[model samples]
Target: METAQRQQQATPGAFTAFARFVLCGGGVGLASSFAVAALASWIPWALANAVITVASTLLATELHARFTFGAGGRATWRQHAQSAGSAAIAYAVTCMAMFVLQQLVAAPGAVLEQVVYLSASALTGVARFAVLRLVVFARTRSQATAHAPRPVPATVARAPRPVPAPVARATAPATPAALCPAA
Candidate 1:
């Protein structure tokens, strides 16, 4: 069963996984970019980005586990933690890109900010996809064996052996000839 599942997972090539990753992670990221911009109006841009990053990472991880990487189930807590580590790196890249953009233009337009943020996200997202496929959600040998159903041993049915009948004996001592027929 585990082999079947592994084959099913392996059947999706890297390109297929990447396409699904883009569809799931990219969708969350695009929405997060707009969310960060909206939240920035009320809060500090860095804080807004951080908030959006955390929320988007959680959502994207679940989507990747279910659809992108064919993890076969919901994201595990360990997978979530590993994913968050990669997301933090992505968050840093985006923040740095925005900071650089701000340094270059005194008042950059929303469109320009989105372009920079999204470009940074795209670069990091590619790396994130690799990490997720290779490390975070990859099923280890031990894990696969642990979850696989154990094979039941086959049992053979046998007929009962016949028992010999017992003969009645006298209370007197037995002769040698009776004890030994060839005496």
Candidate 2:
């Protein structure tokens, strides 16, 4: 009982949540990477990347809300907004890295560009997980414990009450004689 209560009071552990985030994020990343690469093949790099980034961010936010964080009920506009913000940060990192790499390598091929983007995205995953866990899905201690129910005892043992000692009665000779006469 004590251990269970302490566990409830403690903040949620990161290992399980991180694992879920990785699984969900990996799927989203795979889909988005393909989209980015395909879109870049046809459209201008900047426009294709931006459009795909927004779409993928929305999709990933919903996925993470449902599975990664276990906050399906709490998913709201605010969460979407945070997801967008985090995605923007990640996108900026990716774009900047791509630009620098292209300048340094001189007309890098499509495969190389894709690799750079994926690498940047991988680095950004750490930040994204942190933001989602600490900011977006943050729960107060009270809020965390609010939904939990207290355990009811199956049986209760009550202490026995002590018995009082008996007292001797005082003699009453006159009263006894009168009572005897009446009888």
Candidate 3:
């Protein structure tokens, strides 16, 4: 049964997992966009992007780490790093998508164009979030086992003097071989 369960997990459920993760990233992205716009109102786009990226990164990393994956056993500094890296990749992907959208929209430096492009990029990168969650964010099978609470050490489990076996003690006197010598 354990072997079967392990084998079952080896197969990836890409679509379902991606759908869930994408939704999670989408929600985060919406929030981040608002934050960027508010900040960008005062700052230049590039600078605003950097600040917003870093700040939003701080916010998104934790939430995405928790929300994107069902099995969240390993929420550590390393996991946060991985989340940030994946998010940066998603950020880059969104940037590229926005650039393409901007050209297609033909609205040069229009605030509406900026908003539209950013929104669309974020919308498309939903797939990226799912991909990251399944491939990069999900906990390893080994990690799951490793995190399980371990049994106490042998020294703790055992007293210095062990209790005698009651069954063996009861049977010993009744056995003929125990009391009589062999001829």
Candidate 3: regions farther than 4 A off: 1-16, 96-120, 145-183
Q: Candidate 2, 155: how far from true, in Å? A: 20
Query: What is candidate 3's lDDT per residue for 1-183, written digit by digit as tens?
Result: 454354335423567656655576556666667776677679865566667666766665565555545444335677667666766676676567666766777755646645764666566566556555655555553455555456676765555797777664444576778698788
lDDT winner, 1 or 2: 1
RMSD of each: 6.3, 7.6, 12.1
* Candidate models: Cα lDDT each: 0.87, 0.79, 0.60
- Order of quality (TM-score): 1, 2, 3
Name the top TM-score candidate: 1
Between candidates 1 and 3, name the one with more favorable TM-score. Answer: 1
Better of 1 and 2 by TM-score: 1
| 74: Cα error in model 3, Å | 6.9
Give one digit per residue, the lDDT tens place, for model 2 in 84-160: 99999998998899889978997788788878888899899989999998898775334456656676778878788
Native-structure RMSD, model 1: 6.3
| Predicted candidate 1 versus true structure: per-residue lDDT over 1-183, tens digit per residue | 867557464435689989999999999999999999999999999999999999999999999887887766788999999999999999999999999999999999999999999999999999999999889977732365465667788878778787877877776647867666783
For residue 85, model 3's alpha carbon misses the true position, in angstroms, by 2.1
